[model samples]
Target chain A: MNLGLDRNTIYPATHMWRRFSYFFFAIFFCFAIAANLLAQDWIKSGTGLGVERIRIAVPEFKAANQDPRNSELLRTFNDTLWNDLTNAGIFEMVSKSFYPLGQIGAPSDVKFDTWGQTPVNAAMLVFGNLGASGNNVVVQGWLEDVKNPNSPPVLAKQYTDNATTQQARVIAHKFADEIIFRLGGGINGIAETQIYYVSTRSGHKEIWAMDYDGANQHPVTTLGTISLSPHVSPDGSRLAFSSFNGSAWEIRMFSFDLNRMVSFPRYGRTNLSPSWAPDGTRLAFSSSRSGTPEIYAVDQSGGNLHRLTNSGTTNVSPTWNRKTGSEIAWVSRHGDLPKIFTMSADGTNVQQLTDQGYAVSPSWSPNGQFLVFSWMRHYGPGAPGSQDIYLMDVTNKQWVQLTHDGGRNDFPCWSPDNRHIVFQSNRSGSLQIWSMLADGSNQKQLTTSGTNSEPDWSWK
Target chain B: MKQSQSRWIALVFALGAILFLGACHKKAAPAPPPPPPPPPTPTATLTANPETIDKGQSTTLTWQTSNATDISIEGVGAVQPNGTQQVTPTESTTYTLTAKGAGGTQTATARVTVNAPPPPPPPPPPSLTEEQLFAQNVKDVYFDYDKSDVRADQQSLVQADAAFLQQHPNMSVTIEGHCDERGSTEYNLALGDNRASAVKNALVAAGVPADRVKTVSFGKEKPFCTESNEACWQQNRRGHFVLNK
Candidate 1:
């Protein structure tokens, strides 16, 4: 055969080359379509589910001791943690009755697959020893996440408490927050905060401080006078409270560490609700200094004074938005019923945030997006005292009732992350500090020893 | 010369071929030139009767013309006390009246000064003498603790009360006494009574008639709400006077 081909043969070869190019183009087009489909699948798998609903199994916490009394106390802890976690809304709880997994302990020995058998995405096993250590009951708890039977479970947390059996609910709240953090986001565990409130101990009503779960309780003022509306300073080192000693109801400052108390100047005949500024250098409180209870901001050293409200109404319980330092929410009696009002820090552009029945004691969320306050509905005469905790979204001015069917729930203090709220309630037969999820669920009592009320959450 | 001619012919043919190709290509359709951008309609600059007009007044307006053959003025109102106005102009007027133009519209307003009607006349002054004035102004006298007898510390406050009673002979004064938040409520009530009686005795001793000084006891029921301190408590435990003409 001749090595060089003729023109007719060349023409046939060019036609074949054109056909091969078309075939390659078709292949490329199919590949492009396939690659796009694959890319979409990958993106969907990565970010399609914004947040997975975490199903948590809280096996009824077992007490190290088999004593009936200790078992009862553990039952309270179990109930409180269950309620708190449910209220948090971050967990889809598996009922202990249907836990399916046979008694998992917190030593990381639990089979993960056994827990995964149930609809539970994760399992929280609280195993701890509880007893009296000196004057307090020490509870050592360890939590574990049992998701897979084969893999080693993660040791979630260990908690130690010096509270009495009645105050064990607080320790349980601390453990609940730990489980929440292990799942994903950061939260304010009950162990890390405190509450400043007024209690009728020492034969008189005086300002007192206690752990968020109501464990370590002590009096802040010993003036033998009546103190009302005690507030924690933003730095969490001091407390500002209103006391009626001999002059007017003066706002007094007390150092938590030093245990020393000092009085602010008597600006009005009555002063109440001393709320600290976000910067911790000033206090926003309600004072009758201008002849009515209007909101006023004064420096920690009692220097620069600025009136934050001019409605001449009884504006009480002034709380500053933690994120936005320019706005404050307070209870104003400008209408028939006391409504929640928000105003600029400079006493301008006043706007009403709530038209609900008589709202009081507003506490701000850490993000400054919502405010938790006590809502009171007047019944037939005699100081209508049925109050419940309500959360109001500041941006949209919509309120979510957080406590329902509880007998007199009030004074809600938000956790630093806004996930949980600690409030006071008489639902447990006595007034005590209670912790619940911000969404009105899992109502767990925190205090049991004395009549504890007005629980203010500490900022860590 | 033949080669040169061939070169010129190639150059001309190549140029002609490029021109023909350019003409044949898709011409990019000129992107439709964005529809000529719909000639920017001029905004109407409204000129009111006065730059700063008072409440309840009207102003005259005017303006320039461009493409608009007819124009009208609308939305005219007065600025509120907080410096905001709501206007609703019906038809276009002129500089002396109100008018509109092609460049949009303009307004000029005649000063329609709306002075807030004069405040209601001040209420008639109270008809009281110096003595009555003293008694009315001196509302009460706050006292100290434990001692029913008037203390020297409360001498100045008692003197003010006595002076008022001396001036207003026609006015009868009722001394209402109160106690601090401490102690039993019943005990405080009696103590308040004693304190008011002591104040009445002091006024009598200072030349006011005993019949002129009546005493009442609010006791611990009423507190002046002093600071929760020793000094504030001392100020709260006292007697107050209510004068009736």
Candidate 2:
């Protein structure tokens, strides 16, 4: 019997040695490739495209038809406009310190060379004029494309509001939005928005409101009971939230126009986290009417009731797309741990968004493309858990950690523009409301005094 | 040299025979494992003193177990190896004693039943108002952090509550639920109501009617424990029973 290869099929030992060497070379090649990938920079932006923030210059508006009130009103308006641009997270405004020592308040008044110089180097410009009439103030704003001199102005807007400090500031916010919209290629800015958060400064957990920039902080609900999770309707006509009235957690809708709660006491269940539908005709909230906490869809008038999820575990924090109205994102405790999950409106399809650990407080983006939520991975007793906000792409399970070892971040809600996220983090000593760019940059604390949490942005 | 070669060959043949025998022995099946030792015997004793109770009246159950690491009775939770518990069963229930240890589990049985009481000649004059009488026996039930389950220790209190509610069938109750100041106010609202609902269910199971009790959650708005500590938080997580006028 032949124990070796046939003579015609003789193979060289060198061939076998070569094959062994080839296997080793393949392993080394894989290591080299992996090293290259590991050396690449971590992309903090959730989007793959590394887009640069636009460069814009906002010069102080010239005092047109100067009255004694014009000076202060002009100051208020100009300063507000500047802040709106800065907080947008889409623009890098040329600081007033870097200005060319000129007050250009109109498209024709803008000298391109002054703005084109080393300090400003602006590709876009926002110049405006403000003045006072009898009982109202007039404001005219012009946005210019500094890079393309042949093109017409990017935007031109005018406002006539009562001659009050708030009206002046509001006018500035509008002009700033015009510049942002034109630059952002039609995505509206959140300058004129409001953030409703739970602040304990009033000695009770009350619903409070503040401007997007954290000004005009005032209590919205004076229930003297614990009220939380304020969700504004898309048209800004109603505010939906949950209040604990010593009996049960009931979903309460406060009509802004009526300045009182609309009587819809049909629900007598443990209801919480009431979210408004995009059409403003219905609402989605978690209610325990069926023995266990489940997500339910109800008409705003508490009719057409529908149960959306039956996950059996505690379902909570339901947020709608408010863009297409096709999907709803919420946190559910299925198979033991709480994680983000998405389901159809009619409760047909249920898909878990998170694979492991505790993830909750899911806020669906306006574009219906992403979900921002608080997550603590490997959660257990002594499991070294750090709760942080994470952004996830809905189509794929791809995600980027938005907050790395910040002090216990939770309750992230997306802004109306979808470019920013507001979440509560205890990183700055105490729990406070903080906002950051949707890509996880430009994280700025919004509330400084008292314990603040669960911030919900208003509709544009 | 011829003799030496012959001896070497014989020695080699002899060693080869031993090798052949060893290889043949390898084909035989492996040895079987020894049988496990018999489970240790355990003894459990359970008894109800009165062995009967009225619809909402309380009865005492005493239990004793030997060689047991943990012990519990049917419907009641984990208990001491030798201890007594007061139970108020709405119906005739067979109390099963389960004792577990390293050796094995052993069980015993006791029964408590609802039976009609003998008629008395006369009744004493009313001492307290219906509201005052109900309030005298029924008290608030507390809960653990982030949990809404009624602990076994609170079973007696809940039973007394059911008894009072049953005695005054027309009286109504408001179960105001509350939570500690740790979690989100919105989630805490649900947690607080869960506690209230758990208590209401317990009372209903113990012979009290469901419609007589309504539950509300105040979340962390009305905390019994004001300080931000574990002790205070424990005090705050409660379902306070309030009589409705």
Candidate 3:
């Protein structure tokens, strides 16, 4: 290992004492280089390019005790953990059939050779054990680098909660989020995030919320009025929406922590589509209190009302850039067809991002780079196009259609992680909420049995 | 000698009397014009917090009067000498707050520009009175797909409706804007608002009152026809008029 050095120049004119010292220095330098190589975070750097994907395997956790409840809890945990990892979008999941036989509950039972070989070929492996300890279910999970036997495990986590199926799922989500944060390059996993949307299942259009994976579907607002546009605050404490207050449309606020409607001032007239600023201190909504529907910004307490658009057109559906809160994208009806526009938060430097189409429901991406909206490019009667969701680069106005021929897909909202999008579609015979990858893959239906629309993913 | 001295004295006395009268005349000429005693002039001010408002919306009219005993707002009648009142003016009006005092009469005006509601459409053939006539004359104004502006072809319909509304001055109609099942719920609600407002404004321009022509947007929630077709959708996108008794 010459290391590009001149060996003759170093060996000549050196006594035995100097030669020994030079050898020792060289050995120390080699060890330093090796240590640096081990310390490098390849996953974090590679994830930015989105080019590399780690092949990982997650085996079902073994039940430490034979209690009847253990199997049920373990079943829930295994299912939740697998679903969370599959939705992570950064790993190539190895099939369980290819995993080596026998339950590996402890570190001594793991055989790195079997997992790193062909067929399994998993660079990383996740295994865990679940056991009941007197009214609590405890889970111990590990992520081992199967390819590098000498390297330490990527993550080792322990979580304990009530001995219930729900708690099992909770523990699984926590463990999977830890794995995602370590291997998916430091971005917090959205598995624990909730999505707030409107559902008519309860006999009225009220605000309903569900887990990010569509579990525990429940209603948040029992206002019993027609509520549209549920926008969660950045802090996940309050929800602002437009509801018919008997006489006219008014923007209303609901506190999730309080489980009731909070006092938000009535701006009067037809107010709709309340979108919170990223800081959660203010909100921008459309109000006809000014004669025509125009965008207005107000504090979270419904004060300091500032008019953002005065075009005298029907401006609605305003969404803020969640990362910067500097730009707001909204649907404006200034021209023949409704188009999407972006402007500074103070309502200066107006720029139109859509040329032709009935574009509406513009939601800014969490990273502030793209906007997802619903567009009908070929509008008018007899036009042969369907309303579909699209993702656009806000800087260049370039766009990609996310949903194709999906029956009246609209109201596309980006998840907080910027990795998934939840939107409403009528393709399933009725209006329901659906979610997909940000790049338009892995489309899944999240709601059924009722007409649901206008999903807003919570900001974690 | 006694007679000459007496004559000189008399002449001096006459001259002194003339001087005294001349001085009195000059003083009277320079005196300030007097009409009894000066009285304090009444001061009054009136203002509307929101000077402009929608037809059904309300605004606060704050007023202050000084040196006033009798004060009254023309439309509001007698109010407090200094206070605020919420007024929902159906039409644009200038409220005059007249403050009367012992000194004089003072009037302060606060102009509240209320957005006038749409007027009635053009008259149709003779019909029965009241609800029946309203139903027969006030036609639904249809719109183009995804368009809120009153279409060119639909101009005559709005005109006729406005004329009818103008004839029935006592009648008020609620215009419900409906959209076809095409756009998002929120956007359609806004589109429906535009459609209803467009019709209402047209009627107002055609001589109808805005307060009489209230507007509500149903968005795509309530469809006239549930079929998913062009004909049904065309029927669905309309500014429907309902006679409010």
| Top candidate (DockQ) | 3
Question: How well does chain B match by TM-score in each candidate?
Answer: 0.44, 0.47, 0.47
Question: Where does model 1 exceed 4 Å of error?
Answer: A1-53, A57-89, A92-108, A119-145, A148-176, A262-268, A335-337, A355-357, A376-387, A403-409, A424-435, A444-452, B1-245
Specify the poorest-scoring 10-residue window by lDDT in model 2 chain A. A41-50
lDDT of 1 by residue, A142-236 (tens): 55545433434444455556545557787777777775555433434444467777677676767777765555788777878666667787788
For residue B51, give model 1's deviation from the true position in Å. Answer: 99
What are the RMSDs of all candidates, in order?
41.1, 31.8, 27.3
lDDT of 3 by residue, A224-300 (tens): 88999999999999999999976679999888799888998987768999999999999999988867789999988
Q: Pick the winner on TM-score between candidates 1 and 2.
A: 2
lDDT of 2 by residue, A125-232 (tens): 788888897998999988777766567777888899999999998888888887766665466788989999999998888888999888899888899877888998
Q: lDDT (0-100) at residue B71 of candidate 3?
A: 88
Give Cα-based local distance difference scores for all models. Answer: 0.60, 0.76, 0.81
State residue A376's C-alpha deviation in candidate 3, in Å: 1.8
Off by over 4 Å in 2: A1-51, A311-313, A335-337, A383-386, A404-406, A426-431, A448-451, B1-145, B152-172, B227-229, B243-245
- Mark the 10 consecutive residues where model 2 chain B has the least summed lDDT: B1-10
List DockQ, one per candidate, in order. 0.01, 0.19, 0.37
